[model samples]
Target chain A: MTFLSASLEQSPSTAEEEAYLYLQRGLRLCRYKPGDRLIPEEIAAEIGMSRMPVREAFRRLAAEGLVTLRPNRGCIVAGLTLDEIYETFEIRSVLEGLAVRLAVPKMDADAFLDLERLLDRMERAGQTGSSDWVVRHQEFHALIYTLSGRPNLIRKINALHVVIEPYMRFWFDYVDKPLSAREEHERLIRAFAQGDALHADQIMQEHILGTAPLLAEFASPVRR
Target chain B: MTFLSASLEQSPSTAEEEAYLYLQRGLRLCRYKPGDRLIPEEIAAEIGMSRMPVREAFRRLAAEGLVTLRPNRGCIVAGLTLDEIYETFEIRSVLEGLAVRLAVPKMDADAFLDLERLLDRMERAGQTGSSDWVVRHQEFHALIYTLSGRPNLIRKINALHVVIEPYMRFWFDYVDKPLSAREEHERLIRAFAQGDALHADQIMQEHILGTAPLLAEFASPVRR
Candidate 1:
């Protein structure tokens, strides 16, 4: 029931929770693209549940900004405007900046190993042009933020990532791979190793801000 | 309904919206203090409605971290551990720091005048030991952050403020007035006026962090 991240590791305890997770994963992975309508009955039949849990899931997703609930119409996948996409990146910059600043002091050898593993996975995904690259990209940042030990801050930052992930997926799918992204993250890891919180904070903010304009420009042509 | 802030300016469009706002205001203002059980029937009676809307409100408030929804026990006002209080302040420090950093460039003669007016009202509320002081204090900060022109970021920051305001009210109610709060804010305004975003950011973060230990200490004895 925790909306902190998109992790599917935990099993759902309730039908509504199950429905929510199913729909959320679908939305996050761009299975339900922006402007797609979600019919409660259709989703309920698909999930083999009554319509009520699906309706409740819609409300929860609406609260999370993952979907829009219309008065008479059904739920629609929430799309960010070009401006909204940039605004989200700006917000994520400051929040994830705070994350790495706090995280650097707490990063131990184990955390560094986990970071390296995720980096390796991302590089592999990038070479294969696998969609898993976007997910690994997210996990790499999530791993760093989780070390901050501030659950509330990490939760808020992860929610932003959830809202913006589809757009990121869209950018990666249609546009060319970011050639500098790996280099930037490598520099970021080096900065983290230095244990300079402020320096790491700057690097993290710039790392997030670095992707904003590229996504904005790519998303501009396709408003949906 | 907008979960932006505790603004009662707009009329509610639905029964659920009405109940949500009422409960939100009560929780934020400490009318229903931490750990208080909110019975749907009682609140529905007070609002002249059925229990359905009140229950819906409980779900929304639960999503907001203002209340805990036990499976069989209904809703209870959420109580924070001492660690949570400190953690929230740290989160607010960075978010509000970003706020002022963005807000400085947007400040103008009119905005300065508005800030002075709110400060005046806050001073009067403090002198009278009026409960309105907590509200005015929120307004002062909200005024600055609103100038950020980033609605999503502002919305997220305001949600954190909503979660922390009751504790602030508890501190001010039980402990002495912050004698230096006004002076600290004055210094913040001066920093903002200088248009040095980094300095203003630092001041804002420190100003928020400055209050954390004091509130934590005061709330420690009464972990209700």
Candidate 2:
């Protein structure tokens, strides 16, 4: 079910970068829950690095909105409210829509093959109910942005993704229907194959916006 | 031609906040050029604060993309290349467009009055060729985002504005027809007055995208 190995190939060049990556991965994987305070000395001990790098990483993560640094208290992972989650998704819908529109004409056969392969991997992961499914799912969308050749746009989109990842993790855990994403992504791939930029853009927008109600449902009192 | 008074009433609370505001104002006013190295000791001395607060300000500015933090080297003002400029404007267009659309339905007479007053200030600044013109122009646009009532959306828009402000300083310094912005603002105001969200959105998008060519021309070899 794993499309690519779970391991990231790029090694950290410095202790700071290493700490940043370690904390970033932890945040993305939901190992650190929102509002959880990050202790520099403890993290440094766990990662076999000094507190300096961990402190620097905290500053960087704080800038990225993954955490907030209090004036006196240490950094804490940012918790999203329901309204914040909707706003994040709304911004994503437009940015990802623009990415798809820009990417459609630029996509070649090799890009299509890569997307198909990722889709297949996603489907398999869904059937097996593996955690890798979420990873591949994100990759599939990221690949579209990569083809758009807009690194700044991709960077902004990815920032929004990081902020929303925790809510998405909630959705995956509590939501009943897990297999819907495969069908939605299938429509997106079909639009890409047809070379319909507008259609692809619409599909991507709907695909992102569709998550709002599900997330809202998850946040509702009944679900709690 | 003068709009409202040029004074910002909100004073900095902490030495760190004061230092951050001081450096931010300097950068936006073009007091420090791109790639200019910031010396914490010198700035602290100049601002009559301790170097500790100034150093902390550098970290904050670096997080905001106003400065780059090198490994051994001190922080330097970020320089934008031609590609970065265009990418920044492109992202701003869509985000601002969304903001206008959201704000249009929420608009009231008081909001229009506030916008008109800001526009008046901007027009005066345009006529007098005052530096405050740029400040007011930014405020006029920011007012629209404030009316959107989406704080996260406004935050993203403001972040992009910070990144693009230096390039705008370039455009104002080099470009000949500075009055064109006044005319564009007039059109946007008319659209806002009519409560035409679609028209306002389209105008906002075009208004932002229209600057690309002018900025590109400003960056061209002939100008240099």
Candidate 3:
């Protein structure tokens, strides 16, 4: 197989590519369900565009491991078993633990300030049980990547978010008694301010894995 | 914006996607320098294809963080600073260390035997200093992931592999030194066989981080 050319300059531009991103977003949002046979023509007709763009979108998703590309088999949404979900958490536990540790030392005044702002927002959102908290809360932690000074580490952690996202939101939205995510975030910020790496790490670990216990068997594939 | 999606199933089989994969592979091999601006049409022509697939390829690379998207501004192959590289290794060190720790106790005779077989292959490949040995060496360690019992952890590590591939391959190919890798792998395998998790973990931690000293300068945009 050919290696990555690394020539960022040679890539072409096209409407198909833009169309792919649109479809990718749609698919990721479950507008396209697993095992759903996607005819490029159908999508194009729906979007009132040509089939070309939709096809590019599918190719991109396939590359991201979100869709399967069977030569003759067409495509399907990538599915994860219970075991796979638990294993993802197992890995997330370690990666997030490391991320928190790195984030602690680099938790500067600005980082803490932003984090405080976010934590406050999360507290308010949590009281109302709004999805906005969930979104901002992700950004709040992503800020830690800037603090941790580790793009590589952050990248790994970010990918974990992609895999677990479906379950995370579901648990928060559908579970009978969702977590007090605000409390967890609040505890984490306090840990960060204290500059306690181990404590912060532990709290983040619990904060993340703590969600596993509440995931419903059928609704969420992830296991504890 | 997507919580977690498994939708959409349209793929435009364009030459651009193929070009993207080809270009992506080249980047992994360091074929293109950082900050290179790719002309989509030119690349499409050169590859005997249309601009569509090449555009899709660029989109995917940008998503992977290998290249940055400038909107209409164009693309730049990402360059990892020394700090970024270190962070990558540091987190990888711990995560892989955790993987080894989790894997060590789980290895039975059959697994040890397979690992030993892989180790022997590495030694031979090291002696000859062949590129294939280096590739297989990765596979050898991949075998250990089975012991990891966590597919998500394995995938995360593999993702790191994709990110660091260019730098690692460039360094080793240029350095003409693969002996250190040989020694470290040997020690690590021995620790596993001896059922010493701490010892194995320590050896791994050192071995993983040890690459920094050899490859740090190469990781940057300016070669030292």
**Of the candidates shown, which would achieve the greatest TM-score relative to the real structure?**
1
Q: After superposition, which runs of candidate 1 have C-alpha atoms over 4 Å from their true positions?
A: A1-6, A35-37, A70-74, A120-129, A132-135, A221-224, B1-6, B31-48, B70-74, B120-135, B221-224
Label model 1 with its docking quality class: medium
Chain B alone, TM-score of each model?
0.83, 0.78, 0.81
Clashing pairs in 1: none
Off by over 4 Å in 3: A1-21, A113-140, A151-156, A178-190, A216-224, B1-21, B39-47, B67-77, B120-136, B149-152, B176-183, B194-202, B219-224
Go through the candidates in order and give the C-alpha RMSD of each one to the true structure. Answer: 3.3, 4.4, 7.5
Predicted complex 3: DockQ? 0.33
Who is ahead in lDDT, 2 or 3? 2
**lDDT ranking, high to low:** 1, 2, 3
Q: In candidate 2, which residue pairs clash?
A: B1-B124, B3-B121
For model 3, residues A1-224, the per-residue Cα lDDT tens digits are 00111221243465555566555555545566555677777777876789766765766666566666665566566656677666667667767777888789877798789888877776666533456765666667767655776656666666556555555555656654445666777778888888999788778778766766555364453322
lDDT of 2 by residue, B1-224 (tens): 11112432257767776888799888876688787899999999998988877876776688777898886688888867777777778788888888998899899999889999988887666542356876787678878887888888877777776666666666667666654567778888888888899789879888888888788667543221
Query: Scoring only the second chain, what is candidate 1's TM-score?
Result: 0.83
The window of 10 residues in a row where model 2 chain A has the poorest summed lDDT is A1-10
| Model 2 Cα lDDT, one tens digit per residue, A1-224 | 11122333368777877898899888877789777889999999999988877877777788778899876678888877777777788888878888898899999999999999998988777542356776777688778888988878887887776666666666667675544567788898999989999799888888888878888767543221
Measured by lDDT, the strongest candidate is 1
Question: DockQ of each candidate's interface versus the true one?
Answer: 0.54, 0.46, 0.33
Clash number for candidate 1 = 0
Question: How accurate locally, in lDDT, is each candidate?
Answer: 0.80, 0.77, 0.68
- Model 1, position A39, has a per-residue lDDT of 90
